[model samples]
Target chain A: MRTASPAPSRWALRVVGLGYLTLLLLAPLVAIFYKTFEHGLAPPIEAITSTNGLHALKLSLLMVVIAVPLNTIFGIGCALLLVRHKWKGNALIDSVINLPFAMSPVVIGLALFLLYGAKGWLGPDLAEAGVEILFSVPGMVLASIFVSIPFVVRETVPVLQEIGTEQEQAASTLGANAWQTFWRVTLPSIRWGVAYGVVLTTARVLGEFGAVSIVSGSRSGETETLPLYVKKAFDNFEFPAAYGASVLLALLALTTLLAMNVLKRKEDA
Target chain B: MGISVEGAVKSFGDFQALDDVSVEVPDGSLTALLGPSGSGKSTLLRAIAGLETLDAGRVTIDGEDVSTKPTQKREVGFVFQHYAAFKHMTVFENVGFGLKIRKWDKAKIADRVHELLNLVQLPGLADRYPSQLSGGQRQRMALARALAVQPQVLLLDEPFGALDARVRKDLRAWLRNLHEEMNVTTIFVTHDQEEAMDVAGQLVVMNQGRVEQSGSAEDLYEHPANEFVMSFVGEVNRLGEDFVRPHDIEVVLEADDRTEEGVVKRIVALGFEIRVEFVLGDGTDVWVQLTRNELQRLELREGQIAFLRPVQAKSFNGSTPSDPPGASTPQGSDDGGDAEVSAAV
Candidate 1:
């Protein structure tokens, strides 16, 4: 015999949860937008359209374009290798894939610098070839990639493991070659997981700060991204421009979060 | 064409899954590989289908060697125990997958898929995905998908093992009928002896990765090759070195040189038959099945002494036999030699 919970207590619990979310999430989001246009929309719009501000937005988008696809493809490959094969040191390799998640992004940026910067390993040969990596777009992309490596692989591996190889085997027995089996059976099963991973990678690439900041050298209108622009405006006492850029960044984050929720609902359906 | 597995051996680490096993499944005949769990029946079936690579020996389908061929080229239809239908695909798509891969034309593929859905008795459900199907319907869809390629050999690894008993029985009859109509060489693995006996025209009994016996069900039941086959295929009473079935034992009031005196310990009424459990003078228990009318004529009662005689029994000179647990043990037995009477009927 079960009785319904009291309505007063249930209402109290709901109010507490909603209050916490409103205080921590809704209030800050609303405050940022409100502060961005407090003086007027003209100031924020002018600041966003400025050469430095526009270049910062373009650079951030460019970084996402360069980093997200590379990580997505490699992440899918790494996930397939981790889940579909049995070999020595598999546990060690699995742990190493998750190292980026545990380590600070700044540490990853330093490691990339040590490997690709001037006077670093392979730096002399790259210099001889007239290829610059550190303090350039390539270095920023590399840092973003390093920090976002674990998101896709972590999301895809469990899905691949759960969907097992039985359907693949059945396809093989039904006259499907390896490629056909993969394309027809395995890919469709893991498509949702891959899409979810891509969304996460996109979000992480767009908002990446610590590693990109260290690698980009924060040059104005050249390598400086949106987050860097926000920091530079704050340091230069350009409070309106900083608040406007922050508002834009917050909008992107909100859009990504909304997309994730929709994708999750679709996957569940 | 028939499937011939010649001295096939497969091993996973130190565990031998199929140890030099060989058998011939006649063309257009249905066969069953019957064994207990871990007896390598499923492994042998997979090896025949080329899903498992054999360490040694060869498999020939339709008189052609397929030992070196990959599973995709082997053209074998394999149905898994869990009915591994694609969750993302509808029944039509699942059934048409092989045809699509083989480059069948669109119209022809549609016709074949429709025919298969009809043949599997789920004609109107082709638009439903596997997740939307019941377990039995999913298995039927799996069967239809396997048959879509017109494979030379059909292999089912315990196809009905995951279904409920009633569904299993219904599907068993349906599969037998389908086999008759299709006339394709079929081999299925099952641990249920009744399933093997009822559905297979040819039965192959396996134990410990080796084939114990292979023949018609009636032949195997009537003349088992060894102790394992005797106990595995049917119910048997082991008195000393002789194995006898309950139906083959006769009970009488008088004791003779050929008869053993026993007291009835229990009587079980199983609708049409009455099973009488008796203990012999040497403390060996045996079961005898009699019709209800015969029980009334004899007026047998529990704890009453009776003389039991064997109508026919086979004597083997192999190692001592073991019985399944919960079998009635001999009362007041001091000797280490234990004989059991199985009441599997």
Candidate 2:
């Protein structure tokens, strides 16, 4: 006589999975918070008010405001061109759009340095026009944009490809012009994907350090962003100031994550 | 408007999706493009909608050359296989989308949307989103959205393909009534033969990117232009000599002495006729047709021989010599080669 095999116990499996995830992910987050506030909120409070630290925060926030919307429009344009049209070197163009995601931010900063730095390509022309790029605010924004280019494009292209061209065709047959078809049918269809791209791009720009550091010059009140400011405090052996700035950065990251979750929930709803 | 497509051919890479296709959809008539998957019926419909650019041919709608014009200028309404209802919009908003795109007055769009929703029998469901409605209800909403713009032509690609059989049948009837009421030049593509025959006033049969035949439902059913159309339109049986309608048969059972001595083989209930298939004296198999009343009068069983003769003799298109012979076989036994020799007659 044959016998049936026993099924796995649900409670045992659930406990193992829950324990592993909590240990790996939740424990680190809890540790970070505990270490930051162990002494007191006074250190974190004092560090946030420093002139250089506050200026860094303001500059980083300003960069995000400019970079994210600019990248969103650029990403949408690239996605539309790559998916909707055919031209020579189209595959090459697509590959180049994804180049930033694979290349090191340090290498990107070096390439920008070559183009705009003194004694480099286009360096003389930029100097003649009196446009200071390297070691300036514009240089910092450009570096951030380079590192964050692929985030929005990567999120958007797959969505547009999956949605296909049928909806636009239908709208056109209904007497909608090209612009109307795009606005009424195509854009609305990919709004969620675009929002996702924006959130991802924003996260990337906020967390970026290497490329911005190389181009920003670390000037105390001018080009220095918050991540560089944290590094400066650590380099000077100011542990309290460094840890305090790190905590503030963590909070900003957490807030971004919460906003993304809320956006995702709305998309689901 | 009457729509005419002449010698239209469209190809995607190596696959000839629509090859030398010609169709004339009469004004105010509902025509069906009926074919199996990959038969190019959908391609033909897309070409008419100006969605697919043809390699060669012209499409004239209402005596105007629409072949070169863009789809936006064609004034056609298209219902997709997936309903393609805007998921983010309410039923009212979806129906009024085209009007809004055209920048119509707000009041005009609202009134027009209301009228279309009422036409599709979803009056109070206007505020409901597409996800909130059932499959059948969503299909109706999509139809209303297509019609709200008062297009000159309405095209549907397998509109009922996604529905269950019961819903499909009901929608077929509803679509036919709606077509008549609207009296627009409507063309719909369907793989369902019964749906095509029941819903369309005119039928265009396509196969392998080419048109095989075009005619009324009865015309194609009675006389198919080729074998594919014959086998496609309805269930048909092909025998060795000639094909015959079961209703045209007369069965006489051979009886000994005072009565018929043959036993019934199989009695098939065919709504109006009882089909009897049995063996004859020469050990030949034959089938006969009888009225239900006659079948009731004479108890039929297995192992019976039916002496059969024709009530009428008509040659059917796609009927080869292999089929035993139509009811009237002038030349004796409908065995093998004899059927094809006399097929032309």
Candidate 3:
């Protein structure tokens, strides 16, 4: 990037690029901030600390708390399986892990509903046993988990493959068993990659709207998440509440972006 | 304790990496599994380390069979070509990993690790990570780590292969001296014959998944078992159908019956010896090696006829490459026949 080009053209290029970005990204973000704080911060604060707003925030975090860890474990295991192990349908399974990224979130939510809803497969037995999946906390958590599952795995596979098994072989020959080798050699080497994936997964969980919206049933104080509450407040013309929740989501996304950059620098180094 | 493989067999999808190969290393001696690329030297070394499994044989170290055991239980320290230094761990931690795995006391581990670091001459860099070290430093650290375990056997797959020439030579000598001091049973794989000659107490030349021959360096050079061994162990020229060492042929000026006539094509003074290329009467090119003293005595010139006589040339009956074992008869080091191919085009 440190080219020996002429000064004017370089400055022009920089100005043009920054101008485009400021217009598209920074402009809207600044607008969101301005409107959120427009009649002083008291109204947005009161709107956010309300019972429904607090419940929605708590519900969103709860989904993240459950789904991120579970998906992390699944992601690491799936990455190892796809990269290190050989199987009959490895190519097929590799393609299937990308389904969430390819499909719309609403489609995923609909698919989950059809699978666990009252009239769908495994639904009647669940209804009899009172295992509420659809229209419950579990439904929302499942949708969040489904959408964020590929982040960790996709990030980890290339890194695991890049490091290769030479060190693992060396560790084994040095009297370290399988578990020790993985815990010490393999895990340490892939930590940055896993962290990047975790950031993406966390971001997805915080901002996920469509899929969880379908399964959440949009309950007022029970199943409603932050994104749903934002939409509902906007529909009801509660500008302070909607902008307050939107600002919170944007802050969380920014934090994830910062974390992602730090991890990417570490991975590259 | 020395190591040995008995009737080892392995294949990777019909490409036989190790084909019923068996080798023995005398206790506490340095041996080299040397061959060209894809000749199964590394594969055999891995099988001995238990890093690779053999389809049909057993490996024994210190007179106990360990073929079925896992690599951890085999107690063989293996050094890889790329060093495989643990990037996440400091030099001290990397060297102490095996001891830590065995639950050694912290103080004891520190002492052992420092001792190894000193031995490999990487002292005072224990706190530095592998990335901070240079290429030679990393490999030296790998050696220190491998030797820290003090296993019954040590296996290296082209340990100096990734280094530049000067460093490789230095490391080869350093390794040889280290082996001498430690007296550990070490087996390293390499493709360079000179490296094998410089250090190994015994040389095992492998070709196409089979060990063509195994003996002392001088033994293999002087008494090759086949054409592959003769050609691969040193530079050779195909004088007619038989493989001839350049130094084995002598250039003479007289037209004698023992001499075959050839026009000198090129004469190169290669630092230590003079290499003279001759186009034989049959249009085959053959190189003859001479000392500066010998060249001066002959007074040979390019494009001039030179009558060459084979002296002590180790020749084979059938020197065709890719011939199976036992298909060719060994005419080297037996009957002491002169390599006089009389223009038999």
DockQ of each: 0.89, 0.63, 0.88
Write one digit per residue (lDDT tens) for candidate 3, span A120-192.
9988899899899999999999999999999999999999999999999999999999999999999999999
Query: Candidate 1's residue-wise lDDT over B131-248, tens digit each?
Result: 8998999999999999999999999999999999999999999999999999999999999999999999999999999998899999888767777888899888988767788988
**Judged by DockQ relative to the true structure, which candidate is superior, 1 or 2?**
1
* Candidate 1, pairs of clashing residues: none
lDDT of each residue in B1-345, candidate 3, tens digit only: 978889999999879999889999999999999999999999999998888889999888889998899999988889999999999999999999999998999999999999999999999999999999989999999999998888888888999999999999999999999899989999999999999999999999999999999999998887787778988999887754466678767687987656788999999998868999999888988888899999888888999998877654444664333211112332323433323222211
Tell me how far the alpha carbon of residue A82 in candidate 2 is from the true structure, in angstroms, after superposition: 3.7
Instruction: Tell me the tens digit of each residue's lDDT in model 1 across A1-269.
Output: 64867899889989999999999989988988898999999888899899999999999889888888898889888888888888877789889988888989888888887888787897778988998888999899888888888888988998999998899999999998988998899889988888888888888888888888888899999999999999999999998899999998888878888888888887888
- In order, the TM-score of chain B in each prediction is 0.88, 0.80, 0.89
Best by lDDT: 3
Per model, kept true contacts as a fraction are: 0.96, 0.72, 0.94
Once fitted onto the true fold, the runs of candidate 1 whose alpha carbons sit more than 4 angstroms away are A1-23, B251-270, B273-308, B318-345
Worst 10 residues of 1 chain A by lDDT: A1-10
Could you tell me every candidate's TM-score relative to the true structure? 0.90, 0.86, 0.93
Query: How does residue B25 of candidate 2 score in lDDT?
Result: 93
Residue-wise C-alpha lDDT for candidate 2, range A54-147, written one tens digit per residue:
8988998888998999999999888888888878777998899888889998899888888888988987799899999999988889998898
lDDT score, candidate 3, position A203: 97
CA lDDT of each prediction against the hidden true structure = 0.88, 0.81, 0.89
